[model samples]
Target chain A: MLIPHPLLGPRDAQEFTYLGDAALLARPDGMAEGALGAFIDYVYLRDNPAGVHRELWFHEQGDRSWLVVTRNTVTHEIIDAQLARDVALARKGAVA
Target chain B: MRFSGFRVIKEALTGHKGWQPLWRNPDPKPAYDYVIVGGGGHGLATAYYLANTFRKARIAVLEKGWLGSGNIGRNTTIIRSNYGLPGNQPFYEFSMKLWEGLEQEFNFNAMVSQRGILNLIHTDAQRDAYRRRGNAMLFSGADAELLDRDRVRDMCPWLNFDNARFPIKGGLMQRRAGTARHDGVAWGYARGADRAGVDLIQNCEVTGFRIEEGRIRGVETSRGYIAAAKVGVAVAGSTSRVMEKAGLRLPIESHVLQAFVSEGLKPLIPGVITFGAGHFYVSQSDKGGLVFGGDIDGYNSYAQRGNMPVIEDVIEGGMALMPMIGRARLLRVWGGIMDMSMDGSPIIDRTPVEGLYLNAGWCYGGFKATPASGYSFAHLLATDTPHETARHFRLDRFARGHVIDEKGMGAQPNLH
Candidate 1:
C-alpha cells in the first residue's frame, strides 16, 4: 500500500506508523468534569466502519509528520491526505 | 451415524455408499425459543451445548453464508491454555478441558492431538515472565514446564541457538496443548446440533432486529422474520456491524490477520514453536505443510486481506528464528477478520438490551476459545446468568474501569 503523503509524494505504507482512528486527535481534557467518560469514549470506543475511514498515520521513517489519510478500508484506496495539524486547526477554527 | 473403527470397516466393505451429509439443510422456522446469529464454530458450538448440555429446545442457528466459512476455517488451529491473568487463565483452562473430550462427545474425529507447545525465551526478563506464566498455568489446573536451553535443544535441535543478537535461552512448554482440525470441529458441532433437533439454517442473513421498546423480539433476516425469545450473537469478525442493527455500538474494531502455509515437506516442526522475541509462531500440519502466522495488520479494516509490510515482518521473524525455513517456497496465504477488543481480551456476557447476549471480541484467539465460548454463551442464553469461568467478560468492564488488559497494552484494540 502506497500512502500519498502531502509533502513526500506517494510513500510506501511501511514508512508510516498507524495509530488507528483519527478520533484520537480530539482528545478530551483529563482534568475536566465528566472527563473520565469522555476519555473512555475517546480511548476505547470507535466507529470502526467497513467503508471510508479518516485515520492518523505518522511518517516516522520519512518526514515525521502526522497525516490524516482519508481512505476506503475495504479497497485500501487512498482518497486524500493532508497534514493533521492543518485539519486540527481548521476543525478548531470551524468550532470557534 | 456415529463414527468408529467398526463403522469405518463397514463403510469400506459397502463401497462408501452408506455415508450421509454431515448436517441437514433445514428451512427456517417461524419461531424458536432461542436464535443464534453466525453459524461459525462458536455459533454451532453454542447451539450444540444449548440443546445437548443445557437441555434447551427450539434453537435455530442462522448463518449469513455456509458454516465454517469465516475465521473458523482461517486460523492456524493452535489450542492452548497458557494464559497468565486471573481473568483469562481459568476460562482458557476450562476450554482446554472441553477440548479433551470433544471428539467422543460429538462422535466425530477432529484429530484432537495434544502434542505440546514451546514458547522460546530469548532473554532473561522473558525467562522470568515465562516462569510466572508457567506457575499461573499450573495454578489454573493446566500443565506447564520450564525447560532450560539444553532441554529446548533436545526437543528441537534445528533452532538457531548460537545467534549473535537474540539467542534461544530456554522455553516454556505445555505438554497437553496442541492443534485440532479446524473444519472438523465446526462440522462436528453442527452435526450434533442438527441431530438434536436444532435447525441449521444457511444463506439467512440478519438484516435488523425487531426490538419492542428496549427488548429484542426477533431478528429480520434476508430470508424472513423469525421470532425468537432470546438472541445470542457469536459473530467475531462482523460483531460491530451486526450489533449496530440493534441500535448498539460495541467497543470493538475489526482488523484483518493473515496466515500462511508453505509447500509440503517431511515432518519438520515437532509441535508449535513460538519466537518470544517476535510475533511469529509456527507448526507443521498433519499433511507435512508448515503452517504459520504472525501479528495482525496494525489498522482498522474489513477487507479480508493484509498488506505487504506485515507479510515481510512475519517472514523476517521466521527467518531470524530458523534460517532453514528460507529454503521452503510459500504456497498459499489468506486473511481472516478479527474483532479486536479494547483490552486484548474477549466479551462473553449479556448486552444491555434485554433478551440479547453477546459473544464476540475474540481477536486472534477466537479459534482456541471456540468450545468454552460456546459453552459459556449457551449457559448465559439458557439460564440468563454468566458462566462461572466467564463472568469477567462483561461489556461494561471497560466503562466500569475494570478492563482485563492481558498484554498490559491499555485500551488499544490494534495493539491487542
Candidate 2:
C-alpha cells in the first residue's frame, strides 16, 4: 500500500508503523471527574468501520511526522492524507 | 446420521442416495430462547454445545453468510496448547482436549490430526524461553518435549541449518497438537447443532439489537426482527461493528491477516513447524499444499484482503527458514479479519449490558481455540458465569490492571 504523506512523497506502507484510528489523538485528560472512563474509551474503543476509515500512520522509516490517512477499508483506496497534528489542531479549533 | 464404514458402503451400493444434507437451511423464527449471531465455527460450536451439553431448547444460530464463509475457512488450521501464560494455558489445553473428541462426538470427520507441532528455537535466549514454555505446557496437563538440534535435524534435515542467519538451536514439540480441516470443523458443528433441534439460519445478518429497559430483548436482523430471552454474539472480526449497533464499544481492533497455500507437491512437512526468529509457520495439507501465514497487515481495517508488502514479508520468513521451499509455486493467497485485542488474548465474558454475552478477540489464535471458545462461551450464556478455565477472559480485566498480555508487547495489537 502506497501512503501519500503530507510532507514526503508517496511511500510504502512497510515504511510506516500503523497506529489505529485517528480518533486516538484527541486523548481525554487523565485528571477529570469522568477522565478514567473517557480515557478507557480513548485508548480502547474504536469505530473500526468496514467502509471509509481515518487512521494514524507513523512514518517510522521516513520523516517522523504522524499522518492521518483517510482510506476505504474495503477497497483500500486512499482518499486523502495529512499530518495528524494538523488534524488534531483542526479538531481543537472546531471545538473552540 | 451416524457416519461409519458400513454407512459408506451402504451409500456406495445404493447409488450414494442415502446421504442427507449435513445441516438444514432454515429461515429465522420470530422468537427463540437464545439467539447466536455469526454461524462460523465458534458460533456453530457454541450452539452445538448449548443444545447438546447444556440441553438448551429453542436455540438458533443466525449467520449473515453461508456457514464457514468467514475466517472459519480462512486460517492455517494449526492446533496446539503450548502457551506460557497461566491465564491462557488452561483454556487452550481444554480446547485441545475437545478437538481430540470432536469428530467422535459430532459423528463427522473433521480430520483432527494430532501429528505434532514443532516451534523451532533460533538462539540461546529463545531456547530458554521455549524451555519455560514447554515446562508450562507440561504443567497444564499437555504433553511437551524439548528437542535438541540433533533431534530436530533427525526429524527434518531439510531445514536451513548451516547458512541461515537465525541458526536452529533446538525446538519445542507438542505431539498431541496438529492440523485439521478448517471447513470440516464448521460442517461438523453445524450438523451436531442441527441434529439437536437447534435452528441454523443462514443469510440472516443482524443489523441491530433490540434492547429494552437496559435489557436485550432480541436482535434486528436483515431478515427481520427476532425476539429472544438472551443474545450471544460470536462474530469473529465483526464483533466491534455488531456490538456498536447495541451502543457498546469493544476494546478490539480489526486487522487483516493474510494466509497462503502453495501448489501441491510431494509430502514434505511432517507436521506443523514454526520459525523461531520470524513470523512463519507452515504445515502440509492432506493434498500436500503448504499452508502458512505470518503477522497481520499491522493496520486497523475490516478488509478481508491484504497488500503485497506482508506477502513479501511472509515469503522472506519462509525463505529464511527453509531454502528448499523457495522454488514452490504459490497456489492461492487470502486474508481474514482478526479481532486483535489490546492484550493479544481473547475476551469471553458477559458484557455490561444485561442478557448480552460476547466471545471475541481471538486474534490469529481463533482457529485453534474454536472448540474451547464455544464450550466456555456456551457455559457463560447458559449459567451466566465464566467458565473455570476462561475466568481470566473478562472485559474489565484491562480496567483492573489485569491485562493478560501473553506476548508482553504492552497494549499494541499489531505487535501481539
Candidate 3:
C-alpha cells in the first residue's frame, strides 16, 4: 500500500510502522480522579470501527514523522494524512 | 442418521438418496434460554457443549452467514499447545485434548491428524526460549520434545540447514499437535449441536443487543428480534463491531491474516513446521498442497483481504526456510480477519453488561482453540464462572497488569 505522507511524498507502507488508532494521542491524565479506570480504557478498549479510522503510522525509514492517516478499515482508502505532531499541537491549543 | 460403512453401502445400493443433511437450517425462535451469536466453530461447539455437557435448555445459535464462512475455514489449521506463559499453556493444552477427542465425541471425520508441529530455533536465546516453552508444555501435561539440529535434519532433511541467515540449531516439537480439516470441525460441531436439540439458525445476523435495566434480554438480528435470557458472542473478527451495538468497546483490533496454498504436488512437508527467524508456518495437506501462513497485515482492518507486501514477506520467509518450495506453483491465497487482542491472547469473560458474555480475541490462534473455547464459554454461560483452565483470560486482565503476553510483544495488537 502506498501511504501519502504530509512531508515526504507517497511512500510504501513497508517504510512505516503501524500503531493503531490515533485516539492514542489523547491519553488521559494519570493522576486525576478515576485515573486508573481512564488509563485502563485508554490502554485497552478500542473503537475498532469498520469505517473511517484515524491511525498513527511512523515513517521510520523515511521522514521519521508520525502521520495520522485517516483511512477506511474496510476499503483501505486513505481520506487524509497529516503530521501527528501538528494534530497534537492543535488539540493542545484547543484545550488551552 | 449415523454415518457408517453400512450406511454408505446401503445408500450406494439404494441409489445414494438416503443421506441426510448435516445440520438443520432452522428458523430462529421467539425466545430461547441461551442465544449464541456467530455460527462459526466456537459458536456451534458452544451450543453442542451447552446441550450435551451443561444440559442447558432451549439453546440456539444465530449465524450471520453459512457456517465455517469465517476464520474457521480460512486458517493454516495447525494446532499446538506449546505455550510458555502460565495463563496460556494449560488453556491451549486443554484445547489440544479436546481436539484429540473431537472427532469421536462429535461422531464426524474432522481429520484430526496428529503428525506433530515443530517450531525451529535459530539462535541460542531462541533455544532457551523453546526449552522453557517445552518445559511449560510438559508441566501442563502436554507432550513436548526438544530436538537437536541433527534430529530436525532427520525429520526434514530438505530444510535449508546451511542457510547463513538462519542456521538450523534445534526445535521444539509437540507430537500430539498437528492440523485438522478446518471446515469439517465446524460441520461436525453443527451436526452435533443439531442432533442434541439445539437450534442452528443461519443468515440471522445479530444487529444489536436488547438490554433491559442491566441484563441482556436478547438480540436484534437481521431476521428479527429474538428474546433470550443470556447471549454469548463468538464472532471471531467482527467482535468489535458486534459488541459496539451494546455500547461496549473491546480491547481487540481486527487485522487481516493471509493464508496460502500451493498447487498439488508430490508429498513434501511431513508435518507442521515453523520458521524461527520470521513469522511463517507451513504444513502439507492430504491433498498434497502446502498450506501455510505468516504474520498479519500489520494494521487494523476489518477487510478479509491483505496487501501484497505481507504476501511477499511471507513467501520470503518460506523461501529462506525451504529453498525447495521455490519451484512449487502458488494456487490460492486467502485472508481471514483476526481479532487481535492487546495481550496476544483471547478473552472469554463476562462483560460489564449483565448476561452478555463474550468469547472473542482469538487472533491467529482462534481456529485451533475452537473446541476448548466453546467448552469453556459454555461452562461460563451455564455456571457463570470462568473455566478452571481459562480463568486467567479475563476482560480486565489488561487493566490489572495480568496480560498473557506469550510473545512479550507488549500491547501492540498487530505485532502480537
Candidate 4:
C-alpha cells in the first residue's frame, strides 16, 4: 500500500511500511471531556479506510485508552502500536 | 576708471602703512547700513543678498567662530522640496532653485549633486499621503514622481520588498532633490561675502546686546564693542541663548540630531533613499561611503553627542530596508544640535528690537535650504521687509498663534 506525502508526492517516502493490527493510529484531540466527541470522530475516520482491512485494539489496563490497528502491505504482519492515554503514565507514575 | 584707481591706491596705502586695520572697519562712520549676527549660512546669505540685490554694501556679518564651523559643517547634507504645506512649498522650491544655481552665483563648487531622492512608502496610507505630497510638488512646479513596486524594485533591487514587518509598496521620487557639500556651502558664502567687501568678523563671539531704551544699538562681543545699526541672528541651535539675551523667550527647543557613515564601498546606492515608515535615510558620498542619518537624540542637550538607541534604531531600519547593508560596518557617527522651532519651519524675520533681526530655527532642513535661506535672509536684512516666501516664518508667530507647523508637532522637541 502507498501513502501520499503531505507536501511532496506519493513516491517521495518509499521507506514507509503498513503494519497489520500492530500499528495503532493516534490522533490527539483536546483533553476536555467534550473533546472525546472529536476523538470518536478521529476513530471513525481511521476505521473507515477506503478498501482496507483495518484492525482495532483496546488497552483496558496499561494506559486505559482505545487503540486502532492496521495491516502492513510490505511485511504482511503486525509491526507497531500506540496507547491513547493522552497523558503518559510512566511520566506520571501511579503513587497509590 | 578714476574712481576704481583711487580706491585701489587707497587700499594699497592702507595695506602698506598698516592703516588697513584702521580703515578695516568699513562701517567706521559708526552706525552700519545693516548688521547681521550669527555669521552662519543665513546671515552671510542675507548680507550677500543685501549687497547684491538691494545694493546695500555697508553690511557686517559677526561670527563667534571662524565661519563655516557651526552647525553648517555638521549637517547630513540633503536637499529636497517635497513639502506638504502651502506656505512651505514655494519657499523650499525657491531654495531648490537657488541650490541648482548656487555654484554659479557663489563661484564656489559646493559639490551640489542632483542625485534624486526617493521617499519609500510602506503602507497604503503612507502611499496615499506621499501621493498627495508628490502631487503637491507637481502642482507647485516641482518634479515628483510616484514609483510603483516594480519601479522601486528596478531602481533598488536589493530592497527587501517581501519583508513582513514593513513591506515596501512604492516610493515618492523627486528627481531634482539631492545634496550639497555642507561645509562648502558655508565657506562658499563666506568667501563670496568676504570678497564683496563685507566684513566677515571671526572669533568675535556676541556676548551681549547693547539695547538702549527698547531698541538694539550695538553688540558687545568678546573682543570689544561694535556698533550695529541693524542686526540679524542666524545661529540655528543657539538661537534661544541669543534671544534670551534680548529679553525674549522663544518656543524653540535645542535638540541634537546624529548622523552616521559606513566604511567606503563601491557605489551601490546611486541616489538618496528615505524610508517613510521608518526614521532612516541613506545616500552614497562621492568617496564611495554610505552616509545616513535619522531622528534626533530625543532629549534636550547642547552636547554634540548622541546615545546608542538612535544609532541602533537607524541601523535596524536600514537592515530591514536592505539587509545586504548589514555587512557594511559603520565608520563614524556625529551629532549636530538643531534649534527646532515650535513649527518645523525656520524663523526669519525682524525682532521687536527695532534694528535687531533673526534668521534662526532651521530644524533639520537647514543644509538643503542654505542658498535660498541666505538669499532670502539677505533680502529681508537689506529691505527690512520679509521676503515673499519667508513671511510665514515670523518670530512672533508663536505668540500671535499664526504658527506654520508643517509637521503639526507644535514646539515639541522630540516630535520635530
Candidate 5:
C-alpha cells in the first residue's frame, strides 16, 4: 500500500542489506554513527521483526521529523521512502 | 427621625425583596403572537428583545425543562467575537455590543468580565493563520491584537512561554472577548422577558408542529396545542428532533461537547486562553474554579456523558499550557449535546416551511452569540426577511456550496 508522506521531502532508494529473515536492517545513507545509529536502533525497535518485504524510509535530519527511503524485499533493493510520524508510530507499534 | 440615607436604604431593600415565583409560572397566556421554543439563553434573549424592541408583548418562551437547564447551563461560557469569516464577523460583533449593554437593559447582573481571549500559536502555520485572522478582525472594526512571546509573558506570567515542544510564539488577543455567568445569562433574560409580559412557560415540551398548507399553524406541546402566528426554533442540540417533527431534516449532526472545572485556586488563569495547536480553551470562573473544555466528542451521541479520552486530552492540553495546574484536582465534568452543522458556524434563517424559523447549529460557540442570535431571530420572526448580518447563515447554503466554513474542516470534528 502506498502511504503519503506526512512531511515534505525527496524520495531515495537504497540496496537492502538484510541481516537475517527475521530481522533485516538496511541503512539509507550506508553510514551508521551517533544520532543516526540511535535513530536506526529506534526504527528497529519500532518496526520489530516480520516477514521481510518492500519498505520505504526517509532521512529526517533536515527537519528531524521524517525520513525517506524505499526498499524491495525480493532483491533487497529500496525503491522509495520518506520520514513521517504516522508511519513511525505505525511501524513502532508493529515492531513492538 | 433624621435618617434620610437609612430611609433610602430601607426603600431599596424593600424593592429588592419583591415577591416572585420560585419555580412555577406566575402568569400564562393562552395564546401569544410569537412563541419561541427552548427557553435557553437564545430563546429568552429573543423574547426579551421582541418585547422591548419590537413592542411585541404577547410573546411566550416555552421550555421543556427549567430555564437554562440545557446547553446554556452546560457550556464553558467563554465569549469571543474573533470570527475570521465575513459571514460570522459582523453578527458576533453585534452580539459583543449587546453583551456590553445587557446589564443595564435587563436590570440583571450578568457579571460580564472582559478579561480578554488569547489564541496561542505553536507552529508557523498557526501563527500565519492568526496573523491573517487578526487583519480580518481589524479590518472588520473588531478588536484583535497580535502579541509576541514577550507580550504573552507580560500578559499571562503563568504560561510556559519557552516550552520547546509547543513554544508560545504569538497570539491573537481580543480584549472584548470574555465570559459571563452562564446561568445568570439565562435567568437575566428570563426575568427581563417575564417582566415585559412575555409568558415564560416551563416544562412545556413541544412534541410536534401543526402545519396547514405548508405553514406552521401552531405547536403541539405536552401542556396543550398553543396557537401562534409564528414560531422560532432556538433549540440548539435538539434542532434535528424538533425539525423532524415538522417532516423535515437538517444538515446538522448532533454530538456531546464536554467541559470540566478544576478545584478553586487563589488565581491562576487571568483570562481566557486557547491553544490554537489543539482544541482546548480555559477561563476562570468567579467562584475561582478553572473552567476549561476541548473539542466535541467525535462520534454521534445523544448521551450527555462523554468518554475518558476527551477528558484526558483536555487536561493534557491544560497541563501543557500551565504546569502549575497539575496539582489542581478536577472538581466536576459535564457534557452538552451540540447540533453541529456541516460548517462550524450557525444557521439563523427561515426554513422552507412558512412561519417556521430556525436559529440552531451553533456548534460549540453558541453562548457567545446569544444576543445577536436573539436580535436577528426576532427580526426574522418580525419580518420575513433575515437581517443583513444573518443572511449568510441560510439553511440552503450547504447544498449550494456557499458554506461559511470558518475552521475549513468541512464536516470534520477535529478541525474545529
Candidate 6:
C-alpha cells in the first residue's frame, strides 16, 4: 500500500508509523465537568467503522509530520491526505 | 457412529459405507431460549458447553457464513498458557486444561499434540523477564522451565548458537504446549453442539437486534426475525460492526494479521519457537509444512489481506533466527482480521443492554482461548454471573480504570 503524503509524493506505507483513528486527535479536557466520563470515552471507545475511515499516520522515516489520511478500511484505497495540524485547527475552528 | 480401532478395521473391511455427517444444517426456529451470534470455534464450543455442562436447552448458534470460515481456521495453531499477568494467567491455564481432553470428550480427532514450546532469550534483560514469567506460570499451576544456553543447545542443536547477531543465551520452555488441528477443533465443537440438540444455523447474517425497552427480544437476521430470551455475541473481528446494530461502540480497532506456510518438507521444528528479539513464531504442521507468522500489519483495517512489508519483516526474522529457513520456498500466505482491544486482553461479561452479553476483544489470541471462552460464556448465559476463571474480563473495566493491561502498552490498540 502507498500513502500519498501531502508534502511528499506517494510513498510506501512502510515509511509511515500508524496510530489509529483520527478521533484520537480530539483528546478531552482533563479539568472540565464530567471529565472522567469524557476521558474514558475518549481514551477507550472507538467508532471503528468497516468502510471509509480517516486515520493518523506519522511520517517517521521522512519529514516527521503527522498526516490525516482519508482511506477506506475495506478496500484500502487512500482517498486524500492532509496535514494533521490543519485538520486539528479546522476541527477546533468548527467547535469555536 | 462411534469411531474406534474396531470401527476403522470394519470400515477397511466393509467398503466404508457407514460414514456420517459431522453436524446437521438446521433451519432457524421461531424462538429459542438462548441465541449465540457467530458460529466459529468459540460460539460452537459455548453452545456445546451450555448443553453438556450447564444442561441448557433450546440453544441456537447463528453464523454469518460457513462454520470455521473465520479466524478459527486461519491461525497458525499454537496453544499455550504461559501468561505473566494475574488477570490472564488462570483463565488461559483453564483453557489449556480444557484443550487436554477436548478431542476425547468431543469424540473427534483434533490431533492434540503436546510436544513443547521454546521462547528464545537473546539478552540478559530478556532472560530475567523470562525467569519472572516462568515463575508466574508455575504459580498459576501451569508448567514452565527456564533453560540455559547449553540446555537449549542440547534440545535443538540445529539452532544458530555460535556465530549469530543476537545469540540464543537461553529459552523458556513449556513442555505441555503444542499445536492442534484448527479445523478439527471447529468441526469437533460443531458436532458436539449438534449432538446436544443445539441448532447450528449458517448463512444467517444478523442485521439488527430487537431491543424492547432496554431488553433484547431477539435478532433480525438475513433470513428473518428469530426471538430469543437471551443473546450472546462472540464475533471478535466484526465486533464493532455487529454491536453497532445495538447502538454501542467498543474499545477496539480492527487490524490485519498475516500467517504463512512453506512447502511441505522433512520435519525440522520440534514444536513452537518464538524469537525474543523480533516478532516471529514458528511451528511445523503435521503435513511437514513450516507454519509461521509475525506481528500485525500495524494499521486499522477490516481487509483480511496484508501488505508486503510485514511479510518481508517476518521472513527476515526467520532468516535471522535460523539461516536454513531461507532456503524453503514460500508456498502460501493469508491474513485474518483481528479485534485488537485497548488493553490487549479480552472482555467476557454482560453488556449494559439487558439480556445481552458479549465475548470479544480477544485480539489475535482468540483461537487458543476457544474452549474456556465457550465454557465461561455458557456459564454466564446459564447463571447470569461471570465464571470464576474469567471474572476479571468485565466490560466495565475500562470505565472503572481496572483495565487488564498485560503488555503495558497503555491504550494504544495497534501497539499492543
A-chain TM-score, model 1:
0.93
Q: Tens-digit lDDT track for model 4 on B6-65?
A: 666886978745222211333223556677887777777777777766677777887787
List runs of model 4 lying over 4 Å from the truth.
Answer: A1-96, B1-31
Give stretches of model 2 more than 4 Å off.
Answer: A92-96
Comparing to the true complex, what docking class would candidate 2 get? medium
DockQ of each: 0.78, 0.73, 0.88, 0.01, 0.02, 0.93
- What lDDT does the true structure give each of the candidates? 0.93, 0.91, 0.92, 0.72, 0.76, 0.93
Cα deviation of B320, candidate 1, in Å: 1.2
* Candidate 5 error regions (>4 Å): A1-96, B1-28
Off by over 4 Å in 3: none
Tens-digit lDDT string for candidate 3 (A1-96):
788887777899899999989999999998899999998899888999999999999999887999999999999888889999999999999999
Error of 2 at B284 (Å): 0.2
Candidate 4's error at B200, in angstroms? 0.8
2 or 4, greater by lDDT: 2
Please name the candidate that would achieve the greatest DockQ relative to the true structure. Answer: 6
TM-score per candidate for chain A alone: 0.93, 0.92, 0.97, 0.25, 0.28, 0.95
Quickly count the clashes in candidate 5.
Answer: 20
What tens-digit string does per-residue lDDT give for candidate 5 at B1-416?
11245655876889846445523484445677899999999999999888888778678999998898898899998888899999999889889988998887886678898999999988788889889998888877789998988899898888988777898988889999999988889888888787778888988999999999999889999998898889999998888778888876666656678999988877767899998565678988888899999976554445676766678878888888888889989999998888777778899988878988999889888999999999999988887888888999988776666889997875443245
Which whole-number lDDT from 0 to 100 does residue B272 have in model 6?
95
Which lDDT tens digits does candidate 5 get at residues A47-79?
Answer: 211113333333332334433334332233334
Residue-level error in angstroms, candidate 5, position B357: 0.6
Clashing pairs in 4: A18-A72, A19-A71, A19-A72, A20-A70, A20-A71, A20-A72, A21-A70, B46-B378, B342-B411
Angstrom error of the Cα, residue B69, model 3: value is: 1.1
Tens-digit per-residue lDDT, A14-36, candidate 2: 89998888888888878889998
Q: Write out the backbone clash pairs for model 3.
A: none
Residue lDDT tens for model 6, B206-229: 999999899999999998999999
TM-score of each: 0.99, 0.98, 0.99, 0.75, 0.78, 0.99
Model 1 error, position B180 (Å): 0.3
lDDT of 1 by residue, B56-117 (tens): 99999999999989999999999999999999999999999999999999999998899899
